[model samples]
Target: MLDHCNGHPLAIIALGGVLATKKSLDEWESVCKNIQSHLQGDEESYSGVYDVLAMSYYDLHYNLRPCFLHMGHFPEDSRIDVEKLYNLWIADGIVSSTQDQIGKERSLEDIADDYMNQLVQKGMIQVNRKVSDGRISSCSLHDLMRDYCLEMTREENFLQIMYIDEQQNASADALTDKARRVTMYVGKEDGQSVLKSLSGKFSSLRSLMFISTSTEQDEDEDSCEWIRTLCRRFKLLRVLDFEGRVVLKGTFPSEVGNLIYLRYLCLKGTRITELPSSIRKLKSLLLLDLRVSRVIIKLPNVLSEISLCWLYFPVRILSQEYDNTQGYEIEDGSQLILNKLSHLERVSEVDLDKVDVKSLLERTSMRNLSATCRQKKESLVPFLKSSTIKHLSLKIDAGLLTGNSEMLLSKSSSLRILHIDAGSWPVTQLTIRVDMFPCNLVELGFWYCKLSEDPMPVLEKLPNLRNLQLHICYGGVEMNCSDTSFPELTYLELDGLFFLNFRNVKMGGFPKLLEMAIYNCPLQKIPDALHPGINILCSSILDPLANEYRLRGKASEEVQIPNLNTASEEDQMPKLCEFPLLVLAIIPFVMLSFYFCRSKKH
Candidate 1:
């Protein structure tokens, strides 16, 4: 059966999936015979591959059929954000909240995740990257499978995609009115021209996206104008995404308020200064992302009218031209408006200096928070002790931990991921002990803490930790890891500890480690126990050392070894005698030749 696949990955995977449930060899033989009967066409044509994929598609559960078809809405070879995709699925009404076997209701996001996992099991989707807690962060589709999806979508009128280039003439007439979702791929230089050509009304469109090929181009002031025109045309849009693609500078379009049915709005990495006053009319808005925007928007009081579940704003001023006040709302007046949103769940990054943490935490349902504190007296104690927060990232001044604030996180049982960065003021004292962390943490990171103690001893005791990163955080010369330490650790990184020693790691340490990265740390040797089946990244100076360890283990990993064969050959050759001996020998010969030449001349 495998031999008949012609080494086509999709066909092989689909056949494997089809045969996975056959318990006995006879059953497998029967299935193989049936598959061979269907694969009786020309191998050069992909008809056999398509037939296999079609079987997989038809085998999908009725609920997953639409979810699989939705993959056609994205451009080719794109890594789709898992959260964004899930949210879009929910907004499109294909995935809905459901009750579990135990009668507990599961959120639509959870259901979508399970759907994605099932697709992955069926081998239709590929996982691209995973988060620290073992959840898929992003995913991509195989080229052949994507082609199949596009074919299916066209037959079903599920989506329409326009690729606008300099040579292609894209006009309103080019699009079909049946496509409910439209994704336009255009280069930054020609974005305006493409927008003008797409002036035709899309009455049936519910989702729209603009993906720019060039991201570093300067902001075109007219980009927002076209969006305003688009808003007037597509009043029924549910999802409007410009995530990290096109840059919308100047004011956000007021016409966007006309999208009353909008559920998801993304302006991430844009140059927009503020949300339009008319945006308060989007009562159905669920997620509003403004992360890394040019200026920290002065959220209007009318923002409280919407029920947002995910709201992400900039933590710092991304543009150098903007002043401190422009990037952060130091005034506490408008900041208090966050407390009134009853449905707000996820937010990044609120400035600690301006927000009243107690009120914000007490009034809202935020579970993921990214906050920064530049002030001298602000405390992280409230955030660390919150049992509700599952993921927390804090960039704060070291002085905030002057008192008993260091032990606050021990009470945070629900916190899964924590990162504390004190890189701004390294001169101050920032103490982090093992007892100060929660036992349930799945990922932890420290930056520029400059601790005098070896953090490995304490961090290893974190039984659930899966990922750990330390960048200029340790100041010690030697660090130790006991046997069986970090039993569950999968990823480890060490950077900027210039004088650390690595010989102290015990034989059984890091038993589950899969990846390790060492940067700018000049270690004489790596521990012998850490040499097998681990992906290692290091500076060029340490490449030879790592490869030597791999060779000692007879590992087949490839590494570059610098060549010095010619230099060694040159050193092995004979050399001339000392200057005095050579001069004497040359003088005697010269004297004989000179005497003979003189006699002949005479």
Candidate 2:
């Protein structure tokens, strides 16, 4: 039965069960034969059953293959880098177990090529063949295929509608009433008139994203007025991203506060300052990205009551200066704000630069805090001491916290991630002494600071340490005398350190070390006796023999060691000489002679 039709056995059985009541086996055979005979002249001609069978094969192959599974990491609407996707699949254990044999039999690159061709033919993926690199650099799925993938995977319904330059015909009116998330990308040619026309149509939308790809032009009142009208209409929107090319000239309208359901608001790269005092009414906002907005106004004092987890404000100066003379009115207001947000939790990540610490501290409990400080160190000291911030990044001068720096370091107990950029500090005689280091520290980065002393003692104290990055720092020359170790360290990166010496360094300390990257460092050689259980990857081959020995597992306990002197001599000799010499030097000379004489007699 299977030989009669060129169909997969599983697909054939499933389809046979579905069509069993309609016809007998002989009847099905007759229909399949008709399909085959019809395709004698026209290759594309096939029966309905044959079409269904082919579609089943395509769906099964796309869902089960590693190449297609890896494409799921990219956003549905975005183009993906094929090379990067393949590398990630290799790392994630998605490739076949017999990958080495497959590579030798039919090239690993060709396997990817064939799979991409099959997917494209099946209409499950679209390929852009016009790239200059002669490789399929980018690929995306059609909307119908994407919808099917989403339904089969049961992925979380995060985004619903995405209109990227589809013609706004009468068919789009069907989307007006559905209770789904929506994203609309507008090109430069889509003017205010188009937006005004559709403003009344999106009454039930959960999200509206407007991406303007417009070149800079003279700002007019009509453009700004249209934006204001759109904001007023979408009062129930949960997320809004009106970025790029749009001019925001007038003061923020107080009517924007009516959007009480707004959770995420991004107004990046706009020329606007001073949010309306009514912004304090947006109590449900979770994230606000206003970076490069050049807004120089003091934040609303009521900002402390909002439940924001991520906030990015990279501008330099805020409008209101911190003053202590305001007495109980200011103090009570701040206390009420903090007490209301005491239950606020930290987000996964955050990035801010050159902001006032007082304004930020009152708003959120940040898990990742990346910001520069404009206030004095003393002003930031209290906020650092109060919160259990996991990640703390600061770009400041070393002179600010010189005399009494212990107070700042001791309070950061919950800090697992720390990034310090000490600009323009002298490296010749620098010392940092903390009473107790962050015990839960997992990742640490240092930039433009000189240590002169070894940081091994400080690093070893962090039992959960995983990653350490030192950039443009002059501190690797010193070595600690104690037997301190980083047992859980996995990644270590050193960049632009001119005086680094690791000759006497041992590698057994880092049992879980997987990667080490060093660039622009003056190291003569890497240590020879690293753990045989792990792979060592370096940019250049300082010692080829050692690398080969590691790759072949010669140093492992399972392999017996030969005579060191004889092995060294043999390894150094020419490869052609070694092969013949090995065959000539047998275990017993008499046995070889007897074998040759017996063969001659026969």
Off by over 4 Å in 1: 1-7, 18-45, 101-103, 171-174, 215-223, 315-333, 356-359, 362-397, 501-503, 523-526, 539-602
Cα RMSDs, all models: 13.9, 19.9
Candidate 2, position 37, lDDT? 38
Cα-based lDDT at residue 117, candidate 1: 91
Task: Give the least accurate 10-residue stretch of model 2, judged by summed lDDT.
Answer: 322-331
- Predicted structure 2, TM vs. truth: 0.51
lDDT of 1 by residue, 158-251 (tens): 7778766666566332368766888777665444565565566456888887777654675555357777777888898999887635556666
lDDT of 2 by residue, 460-513 (tens): 556777777876555356443223467777777766555556555454566666
> How does model 1 fare in lDDT?
0.68
> TM-score for all predictions?
0.79, 0.51
**Residue pairs in clash, model 2:** none
* Whole-model alpha-carbon lDDT for candidate 2: 0.48
